[model samples]
Every structure is written in C-alpha cells, then in structure tokens.
Target: MIGGCAPIDAGGSGGGGSDGGARGDGGGSTGVNPLDNPKGTERGLGVIKSAKDLAEAIKIIEKVPTKGRGPKTGYDRDEFGYAWADNAEEIPLAHNGCDTRNDILARDGEKLKYRSGSNCVLVSMTLDDPYTSKTIEWTKQDASEVQIDHVMPLSYDWQMGASRWSRSKRVQIANDPLNLMPVDGSANSSKGDSGPATWLPPAKGIRCSYVVRFAQVALKYDLPVTAPDKDAMLTQCR
Candidate 1:
C-alpha cells in the first residue's frame, strides 16, 4: 500500500506474501529502471521510483537537519532515537514494540515467521541477502547469526548528524527502506557502524549503488555529512 511497493508479483513458492523482483531495463545504465527489477532484489521495500519522488523525499528530510553532538566521533551509535520507532514499533505488530532486529525480520524475512500476527515470537524465515549478493541457505538458527544492519549506522548518524533528530524523525530513518539493506550476518557485524570513508562493501562493484542509496537516505533525512562523506557520495553518484 506504500505506493512504493508497486505490486509486481504476490505469487511465489518463496513466501506467502509479496515477492520483490528486480528492476531492469535493457538500455543504458542511466536508463536502469528502479522498477524494472527482473531478478528479485530482496529489497527492504523497493527503490525510489523517480528523481521527482526522490527529490520530494529529500525536501522533507532537509527540513530536519541533524543537530547536537552526534554519536562518538567514530563509533556507529545506535543513537537514532524516536524517528526509529515507527519501523521499530509503530507498524502492524507495533503494539508490543518493535526493535531494530525484529523490524528487519518482518521487513526482510520471507514468510515472516511471527508469533501469530504478533511481534512476540520470532521463528524461522528465509532471507535472500541483497548486499553480499548471496542467498543464505535456509536454516533455523540463533538471532545473532541473522541480523539487520543499519546501512548508515545509527552511531555513524549520531556523529554525522543524527544526534539531534526528534524521536519521530529517528523512527522514520529506521523504517525507511532506502536506508536499510539485508546483508550477510558476519558482514553486517564486521561492517558495524562504519561509513564509506572507513569501509566499503566487499563487493566492490556494488559500491556505486550502495552510495547512491546512502545519498538518497542522507539527502532525504537532511542528515549532515563530513566533507569526505559528501565528496565520496558525490563521486559515487556520478
């Protein structure tokens, strides 16, 4: 219903709910349709539909620039605060409260093995990681092994500019699909709270896309960035 979902195919053996597909268009790379997904992207939600949509989103975020003494200069603070609540709590199973971990489970998990429509019990679910570009062999395991990474770590946000966000804004950042990506557990752990300047994905080729999304989120949220982060993002954007 988020208009961004654009319902491609709800039928698939992978899960009972909607199955996300890739947006590909056989043309120039610039012509790449964010909605032209031929191979499913295991997206947290989906890509922004157009420059206009992206611009609109940016307008909203710019009004809420990051404030305060952000998270520890280097550590990726989970300091996102209230804006993170909606995705972390306000959605469907939100009554009990939503944590970053479970929120991603519901958003990224295929069947969403939940406790009978409640955010209570978390069970097994299939996750096709998009960052590592690998499908994790299906298995039932501990929660730590299966994790949800904040693409722009909350800690990073704290220093970069998230420290000043109102709870409402933080919740928005937490839930925004553009800011979230499902990746390998170990990779997520290793990359914990690091930014483009300090870290880059092991899959070098994906860096362009990765920065693109990061810029999309930062610009959308009006979050601040050091000169290096801005330069890196601009370079990637080009």
Candidate 2:
C-alpha cells in the first residue's frame, strides 16, 4: 500500500521492463511523496518539505541495519541476471513484453517517440533528470546520455547481504524500479558502487530525496548500509 497514491491493486498489467531508470516531467512539481510511490512508478522523487514528512523519512532511514561492506568475491553483473530482464519475479512491470530499461523511459519520459510499429523501443524523449538537475533531450543514437542507475549498486549489494540471496531475488532488485533511476550518464558512471557516505547526486536540492530513495530500496530488500552511509543519508534529510 503506497502512502500518497491511490491504492495499487495487485496483479495489474503493463509493458516490458527497461534498464532505463525512473524519470520525471515535473508532474510532482509540488513535491512527491516517497511513501505514495512505493513501487517507483511515479515520475520523480519529490521534495520532502513538511517536518512530518522529513521525520518519517528519517525514521525509515534509522531503521536500516548498519554494517561495513564485505568482500567483492565472485561479484559480477551476471550474478543478478541479465540487465533489464523483463521476467524478474516479485517486481512491478515484469514480463510485460518490454525490457526494464525501456519501461522506465516510457514511464518517466515526455513527448516520447517509439520505434516504428513497436511501442517497446523508445527512440527519443525528454528527461528531467533528478541527479544533476538537468533536462536531457535523449535519443536512441545518444542513448548513453541517460543511464539507469541502481540506487543500490549491484556491487554494493554483493558486499551487503545480497551475496546470500537467491539469484531470483538478486535479479528482482537489479531490475526493480524502486531501486533504479535514470540520470546523467556521467553522474551515474561516477557513482559506481558508492554508498551515500562517498557519493551523492550533484543537485543539492534532490540530495534529501535521493537518500530517501536509497533508504526505500534498502528497507524493501532488507539490506544494510555502512554506518557512514546511514549517517550520510540521515544528514540529507536533516
């Protein structure tokens, strides 16, 4: 039951998943509630303006278990299944016929143009990226301009407790929209596997919302962050 939106009935159907992360059209201009967008289907991570909302976000972050990251032994992208697989179980927008990347693009993009005769391939669109606070006019030809970021990177997850998770669960998190975001390619690349302690979105205004999203993913998967990471996350909302 997401907090801010209408009740999401179970077993709703949608198109294929895309590796592209979440995007926005400023639909949530007044501020989007993370509680309401539990499935990450919403356009953006809205600002947490009210004291009550900030406190609620802090409470969620505080609940996450803290631990130091572990070894990277046997870590690989394939460990979580293929990138943007549409069949990952126990996630929104799975097996809808499109890959996860395209699904996200379609979900958050504006003025979208799909490939001829195919609604699945998003050829171009405008993205209001939250990470860098920039609007990107993205096309398939310059696809790397926008990259899908795992809120909790796969390597970070490997170090955290996902090493013990079943392959299916790993795949689920890897493709889950709640754990992904579409941002500037450079920013996403710079964030490779970094926790909040070390990396944050360049956009100061979105930092709080970014950490809240991180906490959301951590809580959903029963994952832990390092003490420093947790502290950093808390500071954003404070």
Best by TM-score: 2
Model 1 has an lDDT value of: 0.49
What candidate 1 gets wrong by more than 4 Å, as runs, is: 1-100, 115-122, 138-140
Go through the candidates in order and give each one's C-alpha lDDT: 0.49, 0.78
For each candidate in turn, the TM-score is 0.60, 0.87
TM-score for candidate 2, residues paired by index? 0.87
Highest lDDT against the true fold, candidate? 2
Q: Kindly list the per-residue Cα lDDT of model 1 for residues 11-73, writing each as its tens digit.
A: 332322122344221111111212222222233433233456445434433333333334475
Tens-place lDDT digits, model 2, residues 129-227: 777768788999999999999988999999999999999999999999898787889999999999999999887766777898899999999999999
